[model samples]
Target chain A: MNIIEVRNLCYAYEDDEPALDNVSLDIAAGKTTAVLGGNGAGKSTLFLNLNGVLTPKSGTMFFEGCQVTYGKKEMLELRRKIGIVFQDPDDQLFSASVTKDISFGLMKLGLTREDIQERVDRVVRQTGIGDLVSKPTHALSFGQKKRVAIAGVLVMQPSVIILDEPTAGLDPQGVSEILHLLQEIKDSMGITVIISTHEIDLVPLYCDDVIVLDKGRVVFSGTPAQLFAEPALLRAHNLRLPRINHLMNILHNKDHLAVDTSASTISTARASIKNLVSAKENI
Target chain B: MSGIDKYAYQSKLARVNAGTKLLFTLASMAVCLSFSSVLVSTLTIAVMSAATLILGGCRLRCYIRLLMIPFAFLVTGTITIIVGRISQPTQALVSIPLLGARYGVSADSLKTGVIIFLRAFGAVTCLYFFSLNTPMNSLLSLLRRKTPGLFVELMELCYRFIFVVWEEAGKIHTAQASRLGYDGFMRSLHSMGDLVTNVFLRVFRRVDRVTAALESRGFEGNFELLAEQEESSRLLEGLAIAATMFLIIIGLLERLLT
Candidate 1:
């Protein structure tokens, strides 16, 4: 089931070119979706529209099958379900203490003190930020700050969380940890996760669905396997194939190995190679 | 600035109620400033510094180092009051002719300068005692209950954004320096102008991004901060009151004696 659906969405700044032009896509329920785009590709604009932070210039958006009204009550309702963690953790963390920052959103919901405490504790534990929660936000490392930012959103119990470049400035270890945390949220909590990132390599490992944007328009939307098969399209949009997938492509196309290039991830490529080698031995 | 914030969060009294600490600080500062007695100011400074270093868990070396920075300025200020154009040479401890004027340190002026210096130092120690013990978020929360909401809101934003802008400025300075932006006088001035302008511009962009992030999390025009969970201890309150009374008694006694 689609949790969010947009039709012919168009958004633009004042007297400027469209930031999002005739964009339309469906974000699947309870699945990880990667929104791939280069700089100025309207990925953030689309996220703002999804969370109802900005009113789209034209076109309609539907969340859970109801049209988004952009009214005060409806907007609040939409925002409660769709949380966006901005690319910069500093932008999101306004409170000094990590616990206070995480609870800011929960407090807005007017939840009971016990309920807010329970949610805050659960999220801090889930994000593995329990020890850091007592520290000041300004004292956190960049990676730690990112985790706190994610915890802040997760505490809100959103049905869908949108992350703009979740792994943009993280080290490899930080990136791996964040992706696994997001994956756990998707599997355990059944929350739909959407991330727009330039980290093409992480898409196959963590994302179930892929949507590509170019010049403020949706260029492609499909499963990760289907998206990677069109290498030319990926190149045109200023994206590169994951290194493992590129190696598999070379083996299939250049080396003429009897293996499917469509198997693009590490696990799948390993399985494909194992099958081909075993088949050869039998022959 | 961020260093002080770090130490504040790590202070042993961080989890205590901010109100008690604030009350003690205000009372101490008032006593320190009102009492012209050098002995009372000395007592105030000793009590506040011991509270900060021993009870507040701030490192002694850092405490002394931070104190020295403002203490140096205080010395410069005291010097102006200590030495002046002398009307009577009889009272002069030392006298010098500078630019056709007789400058001297009088017995009366020395006494006044010493008292004022100690008084200001006592006030500084009291401020350090409070801030090092109370983290800004909890303090802001306390302010919300006592002061105007708008004023507290402004303070909260300013506190958060100051660090953000400081970090951005640091990064911009590094970028400029990598290209030798500060190598020469003329070029350094030009680079500094550019750096300031760029940081000013980035602040606006940063604000828009932060506003969007806040809105996505369902923030309305008003802030909805979580109520701080730190409990005020009756014992701690009693201790603070006792200490303030002690300082007042000492000040009053000194006043009576004189």
Candidate 2:
């Protein structure tokens, strides 16, 4: 069943300069979806709409078959189901200490002290931020702060997790750590994950499906393999294929090798290359 | 500055719990307020200065220099003592200058003004020690734990709003400075209107974003107290209670003897 349903959504800042225009998409249950877009592409607007942070100018959004209303009662319920990790960790981590920030949501949900502690413990252990609990948010390194923000949302145990640019402004190590953590969450738990990012490289590794947003609209929606198959479409959206697919394109054009460009992983790309080269030698 | 030096003051004071430091300051204020004699106030100042140096790792001279920052208050408060023609006998007893006035010094009034100033200093030192030693987060948590609900929320909101206002002020300053708009004093005054408008607009947008962020994460109204097991901080809260008790006894003894 589709976990999230959006239909003919439109949003604008101050009733003009539309951010999301006639955008519609459905997020499947228990699957990781990566929303890809550039700056000002309304990816954030769409995500915000999903959590009902911003009421759409016109359209319907549903979670678990119930249409989402902008009312306080509905929003509170939507918020519990859809957790958002904002791009800037500094803004989301308004609490003075790591523990308070993590407990902020759970405490609001009226969870008992024991339940709150268990959630905090589980998230801190998962995010590997045990030692940073007592420290002030300002004292942390940028990556540590980002993880703390993620841990804050994770501790709430929301059903649908939406991360806005989770890996932006991170060193390679930090990016890998975040990706590894995301992968672990998806694999270990059955929670639905929707991450919006400009980093195309990470989508193939972590996402089960890709939704490409362009000029405040859904330009493409499919598996990474299906999306990468059309290099021209990828180029139109200013998106790149993963390294493996990029290699396939280079080999297909320059080396005159005919091979499937759907190889998403490095290992598959290598095997496809070996097969293509052997086939050419035999001919 | 390097990270270590940046937090040099706070890092050294980090050994004490924020709650302890707050309680100690409150105790200091109570004691200072209980005394009217200049000698007692001075002794409290001396003890406070020493405590900062010995316990808080802050230098006395540097902090005293900091206290001198609002030198205008000292000048103004003393001037008020001279003008208020009260406490005549005490004035004759203490033959100090009547702050450039021909009026005879009122020892009681001068003593009273000086006590007020010393009380101010004691309160200021307490605040300084707390800020210097305890991290903002720890202090905030301590406050959330010890303070009333309305007060805790006010403090948290204030702490959050500080960043919002800082960014607003900084942006206005930058925009003005970039255009060489505020170089002259008169021109800077003119820009104040723009500064106020900009801050309001920015604050509105930021508050909306912050509220949205809070709601999206399921933030209910109340802030939860971190569990005892989760507090990882080893600072002793018991010491604060014990010290507060000792100070109360000292205050009672001093009151009875005097």
Candidate 3:
């Protein structure tokens, strides 16, 4: 079932220029979806729309089969179901203390003190920030602050969590750690995880589905395999195929090697190469 | 400011109830300011310093350094009060003719300046003790419970964004420095101007993003503050109240004696 579905959604910061134009997409429940776009490509606008942070000019957002209303009570209910972790951790984490920041959303939900504490504790453990609960937010490294930002949203127990460029400023290892954590969240809690990023390389590694946005329009919405299969289309949108997929395409198109061009990761490329070698050997 | 913040989080008294610390600090400040006796002000300073150093676990060196910041101002302020205009030579303890006017230090003026200086310094010490022991989050939590909603919300936002703006300014300064932007005096001035402009723009952008993020978390008009840990202890609360009353009584007694 689709947890969130946006139809004909259009938004504009200025009157003449639209940030999102006639965009439609579905985020499946209990799945990881990656929104792919370059800067100013309306990825953030789409995420904001999904979370009801931006009201679209001419579209309807359906949450669990009901059209989202902009009324105070309805918006609050929508926001409780869809939590957003912004691109900047500094912007998202407003509290001085880690535990306090993580409990902000839960407190807004009007949970009991004990309930909020339990949720904060659980999120701290889950996010591997056990040592940082009492630490001031300003003392944390960028990666640690990012984890706190994620934990802040997670503690609210949203059914659909939207992250804007979750690994934008993270180191290589930090990137993988965040992706692995997101995977764990999807598996354990059955959450609908949606992240918008320009990191094509990370999509195939962690995401089950992909939505490609270009110039405020949805150019492609399908599995990563389907998206990567059309490299020309991705290039038209100012994106490239994942690195491994590009190398595989080179082997297939230039070297005349019988390898899967859809291989988007090193492990997949390795398996495809092994298959090619065995096939040649059998011949 | 950052140093005090760091020490505050690491203070041994950080987990104590903020209300108790606030009550003690404010009451001590009030007593120090009200009493005209030097002994009362001296005792107030000593008690606050001891609390900060012993109970709060603030290093002696750090406390002295923090004290020095206000001492410079106090000395200049007191100097103005001590230097008086004397109409007669007999009234002047030490007189100097400056621009055809007699500027002198009288005994009465000297005594008044000393008392004022000590009182101001003692009040500062009381504030330092409270700030060094209680984290800003705890203070904000307390304020959220007591103050008007709008006032508390403004304070919360300001306190949270100050660090953000500081970090952003630091990043911009470093970026400029790496490019030889501060290699010369003129270049340094130019870079500083550019840095301020860029930081302002970035801060404005961040404010928009932060507002959207808050809305995403269901923040309506009010900022939802987190529930702080209940740190109230009957013994500690009673001791704090008693100490404040004791200080007030001392101030009263010292006034009577004088």
Residue A9's lDDT within candidate 3 is 93
The i-RMS of every model, in angstroms, reads 1.4, 3.0, 1.8
- Candidate 3's docking class is medium
Q: How should the candidates be ordered by lDDT, best one leading? A: 1, 3, 2
lDDT, residue A1, candidate 2: 88
For residues A17-89, what per-residue lDDT tens digits would candidate 2 score against the true structure? Answer: 8888898998998899999988888888898889987889999988998888888887887887888888877
Model 1: per-residue lDDT, tens digit, A246-268? 99999988999988688777899
Screening candidate 3 with a backbone cut-off below 3 angstroms (N, C-alpha, C), the clashing residue pairs are none
Question: What tens digits encode model 2's per-residue C-alpha lDDT throughout B1-258?
Answer: 223223432555664556567777777667767765455556566666666667667666666666676456766876686445444444464354466543555666666677677666666665565665665555665656667877877676666556547755887889898998788898888787788888888778877777778878766676555633323233335544554565556666777988
The window of 10 residues in a row where model 1 chain A has the poorest summed lDDT is A102-111
Query: What's the TM-score of every candidate structure?
Result: 0.92, 0.77, 0.89
User: What ordering of candidates by TM-score runs from best to worst?
Assistant: 1, 3, 2
Docking class of 1: medium
Please compute DockQ, using alpha carbons, for every candidate against the native two-chain complex. 0.64, 0.35, 0.55
Clash pairs, candidate 1, are none
Instruction: Write candidate 3's Cα lDDT for A21-73 as tens digits.
Output: 99998989999999998898998888888878788999888899898889888
